[model samples]
Target: MLYSYAGHILVIDLTTGNIEKQELNEDYARQYVGGRGLGARYLYDLLKPGIDALSPDNILIMMTGPFTATGIYACQKYEWVTKSPLTNIYLCNNTGGSFGVRLKESGYDGIIIKGASNTPKYILIDGDNVDLQDASSVWGKKVSETQRAIYEMTKADTIVCTGSSADLPNPVKFAGVYDGHRCSGRGGLGAVFGSKNLKAIAVMKPNKKIEPKIYNPSGLKDELSELIKDIKKNEVTGEQLPKFGSIIWMDTTAQFGILPTRNYQDILTYEDIEGKIDTTGYGKKVVKSKELKAINCLDCPILSGHVVIPDHGEWAGKPTKGPEFETSWALGANLGIIDFGHIISANKECNEYGIDTISTGVAIGFAMECRQKGLINDDILEWGNSESVIKMIGKIANREGWLGDTLADGVRSASEKIGNGSNSFALHVKGLEVPAYDPRGVWGMALTYATSIRGACHLKSWTVAAENSKDYIPVSTEKKAKLVKDIQDLRSVMDSLIVCFFAGRAINKDWIVRLVNVVTDFDWTPEKLDEIGARIYDLERMISVREGITSKDDLLPHRIMEEPLNNGQWKGKKITKENMEIMLREYYKLRNWDENGIPKRSV
Candidate 1:
């Protein structure tokens, strides 16, 4: 009998309105663990390569790990896995809100949704009773409005939904949850929902917590206490993160010259904009003005989320969840915008419109660059133009006009269509827009961006912290590969446990293994758990390969690899082709991939 698992995998076919429950295979759980690992394994087994990402054949899997609802710190998150319409490759987007815990407490390990519906619909899951109800009334509403509608109708506290943006003719690549703040906001998964005619999912509040039958409850309790203590003692998790949130990253990344600025043109020159763009400035201008409220996910001690009420200027009374590190970099330095209020307003707009801020910001930055170069004759798009940025956010989400349609597809596709030399400056890898970190400053991020299966992503393996550490040798590619691989494996484990990445910094490997063992009654060593991470990574890589990713696809954006930093700490530095090739060789060797980055058939 399973101890930590729900012992069931619920499958829903929206086309036929049919729901089926299948037993959770214990052997499968033993091999892949749960959450990301299990989700990837299932995708590999069930999904055919080259299926249209937005088609009915493409499936959406919502999964939770063993630690979810087990009182494990920051385990309230859940993953949404599907073929990405944005990248046309495997994608996994996770969120922390009330959804994962409520889902697990509803007596199901995860949800596998398949097939498109003929009409607009929403899934209402109340314990064993599941219904696909018509969503015609809520169909074209914004994210927050739709969520509120669901809550009023079902009295459900957790709702994951798409906005009218997803229903665009070209469709956007983001979606939101609950308060229109927390999001599964990448890879066009929201567009996939629109394609399937799925508007929202409502999981009713569970009457009682689904208590897992743990083998050693007392021992588990003791270990959890120790883990909490460690988390509290850590400077990042206990203090700065809770107080400043991820906003603190802006200062560190900027100091290191890794922050993407002016559309990847230069990392420095942002000193002038610091007062209006940096975290310190935001705290002084906004946080102190009776407007900042630190928020957190359920069971998270860090309180990494914040809601800022701006009551002083253009955004005189706007409350928004975040202009978090990535979003801030995208909108602030990348586009050269310095208005803090404008950034906050844009954040709220993205949430309501249901678009990924990173992608939206990056895409707009690309358009601004295109305008500067005279590639596009548009007066509205220019560097640091906050008004234009705000206008474009709505246009892109709705796919309103020629510019909207061009950018709604993101930087990659937009560049392809625009084609003046715009593609040269289009900063994307594997068709997904690059995030905040400028690779020329921190080299591990070079490898991280290149090899990420989900495209240019930082979350897949965030190694900037280590690369910036005192012990790290900045120029050496020798240890870079090993560092990236280790972090990826470690993050894989954390994702399965479904804990916040920040929490994992304090939660050690030994404690993680202990928690899993007590919960599942499985004798898993640290090495064994690490192996699962490796296995999951390889599986995702293989899936991407099946969808046609190769060493050729593992590349940094042109500007990042070729352009030297015009100024800052990394003034003369650039990631040359030779440097990147050397690192890729080492990374491929470590992963047991051939020179072409293809996994060998013999394993």
Candidate 2:
């Protein structure tokens, strides 16, 4: 059999103390690609609905995409997924760092971990050799501290760990880490690690090859060489994101009235900030991660890094990494705190703890709203009280109190506890908490958030780009469904190719195909690629539907429908139930899904 991948997939059953390696099957490789899409395929094949998320039966997967370790922009992320204790659906959390490259070098495209371990131990991979280390000393260490200690022991090796004190017995209090900087950052992947008595995964593979070309670019080598050259020659990455890192969009979202403020009850526009959120040469505020510093991936050169916030308060001098678009929207404006340091530090803590920062921020925001309304108490939560917030983080990782315990369930499940009116604003698509954007104003986002298999993830398909495209009006619904659907198909294709979501749109589909063609001579036509994307998307939907979701589960929160942007560029805009339903039906029809949003089997 021909091996297209330089690496293999390693499956370790901690419970059984068995380890095996499987070569990448070309059929599966071409179909699912890597990262989220591959994760779904793996889960679809292995997962049985309603299994306990924290059980030894749950298989935790650490996966990377095809472009990992190749020179591809924003292609640095790796996926960590399981039956999410948060969403209860297929959940894949990605972290961008050097881990993907390391994972590839360790001779695995992905790692599937099953069976629970009885002792606090870590899985260490130094090239092909694997060891189960005693992590008793490393247990309860923060991700940063653990990284330092473990790396010190391993002599500066790249490490991903979840021994942080944040891991509790339940999802409410679970956090894990990818490295010191990036985080899987969601869905209690860390807690699962803790439950398994698994402390960390240390990967120290330095020299490894992960790319195997299935299509050749030779045919288009001369023809499309100019485009590749153009991309290389330009400082597009440097010019757009330098200094601010992902936080560059902070003030911009505020200007557009999309910044979620006060728990989605209001949009904190540039007017509300009143120059407090001013854009500087660095960004609108203190840049936590700087794009000027590095556009690091395995081999890509689009410098993106945390802008190093000079900290204060409990997190004084704490250099937080990102409030990138997601963190910015969820933590910064969503909770009505313009304190950049606080925002950065919170995200930093989430990263260190190995929890999804978006959900943490949103969960806290919901808690704050509940507190203010007397639905809950300051004893439970206090707005802008960083101490309480920090405590809540601890409580969540520890599942300390009732509210914290409830919140560990995430916004969708947690909201159910509020009993009345709270469910209306629970703000989630598929149980994953919504990021900062309020879809009420951005019509395309309504669909994006609603249909996202992982609940409000913008990565699955970025229709907002088309809606905000220079070619179309931002708010119009006409042609939106077609544009969104097309993008979704294209996105699925790029995902299999394992490039960054940003790159999926930054470069054209034809260019990507050509790039792949150069590496492998496969005749990957755009139409065929789209079909592949559609099929994967359909399969993911099937996974969701099989797990018991229906058209009813595909609806947005009522607050987004009831609320309008009270000020700024977007005003008097609110998506009605009828309007949203129509758009959804249209979207389903375009995808060959039934009225209930189920994909036709023949499709």
Candidate 3:
């Protein structure tokens, strides 16, 4: 009997409206673990290279880890894997909500969706009853509305639905969650769903709990208690997170010279400007004045997500989940907008429209830079204009005319289309825009952004914590490659286990091993899991390599490498070409790859 997993896979073809259930491959599970790792392996096995990412040929897999629905801290997360419609490469995005837990309880390990429907539809999984129903009734609605409608129609406990943005002629690169404020908000997966004519996926909680077998329930309980205790004890996860939320890093980033301000043309050097948007500044001006409260995911120990409500002004009395560090940086500092109220409103608008805040913010930043450089003559878009930022959110979601359509295509595609040296300023890696972390200030991120399979993703290897914390691993080229590789491998393990990275920060590898042992039949050690991580990373890289990504493509934008920070304590700091070459050579060597970053045949 399978332990800690449902041991079944569901397949739905939108073209024929057929459903198929298949047994999980134990060998794949053992090698790749689950979640991110399992998703990568399955994609590699199922797909060939060079298919149109928006075409029916492209596949999407929704996967959960062994720890999902097991009452473990941060196990409520699940991941979506697909060839990105934005990047045309492999992509994996995770979201936190009750959908994953309900999915597992419904007795399926994961679901693979393929083919495009002749018309718009939504998937309904009510215990054994699964069907593709017409979505025309709800297709054009906003995220919250679509979710509410789906819940009302299906009475499902959990739902993942696309926003109206997905139905646009040029769908924006993100989508929202209906179950909670969670979102699968990256790599334009929502646009892929739109391309496939899928509106939403609604899941009902299992009538009866189908608990995965556990070897030692009592021991597992004790381990869980210890983990919870450890989390509560950790200052960052327990105190700081619950108190300030993820935006706590705004102050740190500002100090470290990593905060991307004014489209990254300058770092946070001005005290007055920094003080306006920094954590304390925001707390006083926004949260305190508005009386917004903090909220956590279901059973989440660290309440990193907070509800934002403004007491006065345009967005007064409106509530939204967050403008996390990245969101705040992208829409706030990057745009030169310091009003916390405006930032909060923009965050809410982005969520409602089912847009990826990072991508949308970057797209806007790119547009502002382009306009500044006379590359485009967009009157509606200007740097530091919060009003314009808020308006563009709706325009982009609806694909309103040239500006909206162009922005919806993402920074890389948009820049390439409107070239007059725009690509030089377009901040992206492998077609995906970079997140808020400025790689120049945090040197390790250069390698992280360059080599990440999902293109300029921070979560793939979040080494910034090491750089900022007392880990002693300085953000330098000398040690960054090894540091990045190690973190990537470790994160691979965590992602497979489906533990939130925040929780992983508090728990150690040994604790994770114990959790696995108590829940699964396999006796996995730290060393074994580390090997699995390496395998997972290698497999994901291989998929990209197969898609024709070369060492040349494994690079950051010229702005990050060539242009030095003009201001701040990190003035003149940039990842020089030589520095990147050294780091890449070392990183490839450590990964057993050739000079061109192709994995050796033995690997």
Candidate 4:
């Protein structure tokens, strides 16, 4: 029987040493296109409702999409999905690296990994061949080091392996690790891998060149040409992003007086916004004035990377991926340290350590707030001390010392333990920490933060697109529900298409359909195709609802509600609880969700 381009999703049941490829029917692919959408569907199907998140029975899928490796926008992306050990809900982490491209070249769109291995093993895939190899020697290294050693062992194959051993004997044996540029860093997917006795998964390119599985449109070349031109003309994707990446937004976010300062105690912009911020937070500033080159992901041209900062702090002129606007805001203003160089240094170190810099920064910022309020000693933050901050990240990752052990629980759980009203300033929504944009100044973010499915994620649907930009009307609560819902569906479609968020202008629905139809032979409309996005988003929300998330869980920290911005452009602005309730109720109605933020069954 002929299958679509995706064909059978390779299923490897490591428990009984059984391996088989299961056909991916049209129904599965239609509702959940690929990557996150596909991963969500597969995991939700197999993972029993309310199962322990770290159980071997919990299915883990590493999936890609039809657009992967098609020379399209950001096609070099993949998703590692499972029930999150951290949040105990649908945890799908999307990473943009060469793994998916290699997998696609190996003639497969996705793989499902279930059951546990009896010993440390690595899943090696070269086209259709699969090998579960012994990984005893590779178990105890840091994440990046693990990647290098795995490559050497596998003869230069691209590897996605968990970093360091589970060190299963440690306090948080679940501190599982992995390597590659972008990571599924939020949820403990790595730990779930460790739980299964799986160390690494290397997707190798096949030696035998495989032909394309479906028909390619004769018009693909011309369509690509127009897309490139459209991308070149877009301002953020073209001009501003090229120079500053997301770093340019720092001063802008600061100007709004809502940049998550001092763990939400002060919405005030730091005095150091200009003095402490620099260009290195954007990409490889190693060459100095020799034309700074930004490190972009996959097929993106937005140049979200930054050059290195000159010697100022612990990391003096080290080349790195970034201290994007989110990292800078959480690590800098949120902590009251404005030294751009210092913040960049911390951000780089966190990435290198293979931890989520946003979470780490916010976690540390939470710790600092604890210190200021006398919950912990002041020695941890040590005024204007960048090295201490770096040291703190190391300790937290390793779960060392008292403060580090507490912080390893992350900001929310950690603050709750300290029990001194520290919970009020933790500034986290559902254990996962909040991102840069302060919801206080941008009232729309209040709903965005409170209702985001991924627990305070900005990317899920960055309403700031409508709030901050001149093209959008700010502070009008009327159309926000429709606005965020549309953008979210757009984001979902992009995730499935595996395209960058910047490609809406260039890669329109027709182009997307062409990319999909040509790749898989399914002639889907832009509207119908976009509906798949809505379905994926709804499914994700449904997973949360099943995991016990509801309207009561939808909340901004009490500090954001009661506290006011003491300084900067929009001083004294605050989000009132009454207005917060009004905003979310509207959003729920728009999303076809009940007042309690649960998806309405009638829809």
Please, what are the lDDT tens digits per residue for candidate 2 over residues 338-420? 66666666766666666667887888888888788778766736655666666776666556678877887787777787876
Which regions of candidate 2 fall more than 4 Å away from where they truly are? 1-4, 163-166, 173-176, 206-236, 278-299, 318-322, 379-388
> By TM-score, how accurate is candidate 4?
0.91
Q: Write the per-residue lDDT of candidate 4 for residues 1-603, one digit (tens) a residue.
A: 222344657889889878776777667776688888887877777878788766778888888876777666646677777876666767767676677777777777788988988888888887778888888887655677777778888864567766542434332322434436555677666767878888788877679744345456555556667767767787766676767777767766766566656776665454445545634333334234432332445446655555566354545665555566777776666677766667777766665455676777788887776777778885748544677787887787677788877776677778778887877887777767788887777777777777776777787777765686775545446566667777777777777768765455456567778777666666778788767777888888887788888889888888777787776666677787887777788778767788778887521
Give the C-alpha lDDT of model 1.
0.81
Q: Write the per-residue lDDT of candidate 1 for residues 1-603, one digit (tens) a residue.
A: 877887788899988889998888787777777888888888888888999888899988888888888888877788878899889999987677777878888888899999999999999988887889889989889987898888899997578898889866557754433323577787788999988999999988777766656767888788788888888889888887777678778877877777767788877444755766666777754443222332357757677777676543345575656568788778767888766777777877787788888899999999888888888888978888888888898888888788887888889889989997788899998888899888888899999999987899999898888887886866557589989888888788778767787777787788788888888777889999888888888888888889988999999888888888887778888898999999999888888889989887421
Q: Estimate TM-scores for all models.
A: 0.96, 0.90, 0.96, 0.91
- Candidate lDDT scores, in order, read 0.81, 0.69, 0.82, 0.70
**Can you write out model 3's per-residue Cα lDDT over 1-603, one digit (the tens) per residue?**
668898888899999889988898889898888899998889998887999887889998988999998888877788888898888888988778778888888988899998999899999997778899889999888888898888888898888887888887556765534445777888888888888999999888778877777767888898888888888999988898877777777877776777777777877744645567777766664343232322356678787777668553455786666568788888888898877777888887787788888888888899899889888787867877888898888788878878888888899989889998989889999988898788887889999999998999999888777876675444477688888999899888888878887777787788889899998877988899888888999998888888998799989999999999898777788898999999999999999888889888442
- Position 162, candidate 4: lDDT: 67
* Candidate 3's TM-score: 0.96
Candidate 1 has a TM-score of 0.96
Residue 507 lDDT in model 4? 66
